[model samples]
Target: MDLLKRRLDIAHVIAREFLGIQEKGEQNLLECWLQEDERHRMEYEEIRQLLVAGEEAWKELEDGDLVAAACWQELQREEKRRSQWWVVWYRYASIVVLMLAVGIYYFAKQESPETIIHVETAAVTPGGGKAQLTLADGRKMQLDDTIRLTFKEVGGTDVSLEVGVVKYSGVDTADRKGAYNTLTVPRGGEFALVLADGTRIWLNSESSLKYPVAFTGNERRVEMTGEVYFEVARNAAAPFVVEVRDMDVRVLGTCFNVTAYGANVVTTLVEGSVRLNRGEEHITLSPDQQGTWNGDKFEMREVDAQSAVLWKEGIFYFENDPLEVILETMARWYDVGVFYADPELKNMHFSVKIKRYENINKILGIIAQTNRVRFEIKDRVINVYE
Candidate 1:
């Protein structure tokens, strides 16, 4: 028991030194001398108890954000102190060295920028491809062209954007029959639109939206594959609906996000009531509530809506989204296929907010810090390992 207590005392000092709270001194050697004396061992126990008490004080946390920050800061301070005592206590230097190596490895990973995912067919990537839109007239419009048209389609009639969101009425489509427009958002692609009803829809990568030039009935509907963020125009006479896969969402002109990429579909409402149904399961949501489904059943709960659909604004938000969800987004945005080395790693969860422009390596580095897992980017492919 004495030996065990002595070791714990030494571990407490090393932990503090590793956290960087102590000042510069003899390093590991000084730490070794302290372990030879029983009196010093007793002092070490005292210090350990103090540290334990401090940890307990933190247990009564109120705000999660503040607690996380405080915890991280305390860890950092302790590690810094541990570093100075490391050389003095050469016996305990191994732990200090290991942590330092890990921190240094993190820095090295950051220095090496990684390529964007799956933009290329192979792991060693090339460049991404551009998206093409098929207008209702069967005309293909390459978005890369210099000729930019504004008055696209608004409120079943047509309207144009003068500048930012300035409205210019569209000409009557009475000359033609019901026309369908196929808008494809290729990998690494995104765009904004003013719907026929003055609604704004932002399309993310690997997404496609099909809509008619005008609405003929009391209900407005559009087809979607992938994901979209919408601000519906208020129309009491006609409600707006989005149909994708097995899910259909009815909205009365409010803001919401819909992710119906494949078998799973998630609809999160920001403001206004939304009626969602997947087959027989139907649920109505108030603001801040989301419906999660996968063709079989539907569930509603409160969620962080921004994190659910940040892709629409050219930002990626991860609020404890699992590896599966993150990989799905990565596959869509970077246009790559993921091969798992082990099944367990696929279930790991991470929380990070990143912009689309940052290279894959930066995000991977952030992820590696939380867990022992590491990511290696080879051209267009990323290898994840624990």
Candidate 2:
């Protein structure tokens, strides 16, 4: 056989063997291919990792033809690098990155009694990551394209609405009289803002923030629900305060993320210092520290702040998270409702990183790949069962 054909035959054998469907007589052929050269062993290991641990990358299969074509192109590129002596083994490792991706598609095709998908031609599209802004005067604007506007006297101040950001350039600590504007991000949407004080804010899906059009009083305060990441502008004189549920996070020029939804209130400090005021009790948090307020008390612990803010960077990071938690989060971002046929499935754990824009079905597929549970989507509702 020609080199290309030989490689193709070897790949077929390896794939079949890995799937445990190779003929009894094919074991010798697979063993010989592995032992023929050191390069073969290395390639097999790379493909094995792709099959076993490439769930994050395989998520793109939701795009159908585009994802399939991309995986094939990546595999071919890896095969081509085999002819280059100086390319090094590590360089071609990327070629096998999508090897398991192709395997997933093929595995699903065999109608393996294990993998079950209920819908045909499922196309529940992802969100576009946009939010609606309500001006201080009760005027709601859908921020889609670029536009600039000056608010007419709602707070007796001029607030500039440019693009998707609202900036109050003229600082009026004196205008404690300004109106407070609210920004609401509906389910399956996200938004960013540059506050009047130059503080930057990123709002996740199903969240809202209420802020003044201009700074006022001795402190700058904003009320938030759901989740938000903030880079507070430095103003030691006028501390920035975020009110979430029953907790008040007071900071003077700091970067932090706050998640307050349902009955949970979590504050993660990324930089600077923050004090959480829960009624009469005050708790201080330093960098890399997280505080979770459970109704009546605050619990503090050191954590990986980057993971907490991953949503702001357009990624989903789950570290051994419970299945119910994962479904709750995905429900917000995908605008779907989650129902569990077996409540015990909520205890299952998963760890994976997925892009925010990926289709919901692919994400569910990743969970289903664990083989511990199955999923069905009907009218934007996901039903899970084991």
lDDT of 2 by residue, 35-151 (tens): 865656776786776556544434433244574556556655766666543232322233343343444445456534545656544567666556787876688887643667776
lDDT per residue (tens digit) for residues 10-70 in model 1: 4545555645564455346446746555554554454445445544423323133454445
User: Which pairs of residues collide in model 2?
Assistant: none
The local distance difference test score of each candidate is 0.64, 0.75
Deviation from native of the Cα of residue 164 in model 1, angstroms: 12
Name the candidate that leads on lDDT.
2
Residue 94 C-alpha lDDT in model 2: 31
Which parts of model 2 are misplaced by more than 4 Å? 1-116, 120-122, 145-164, 172-178
lDDT of model number 2: 0.75
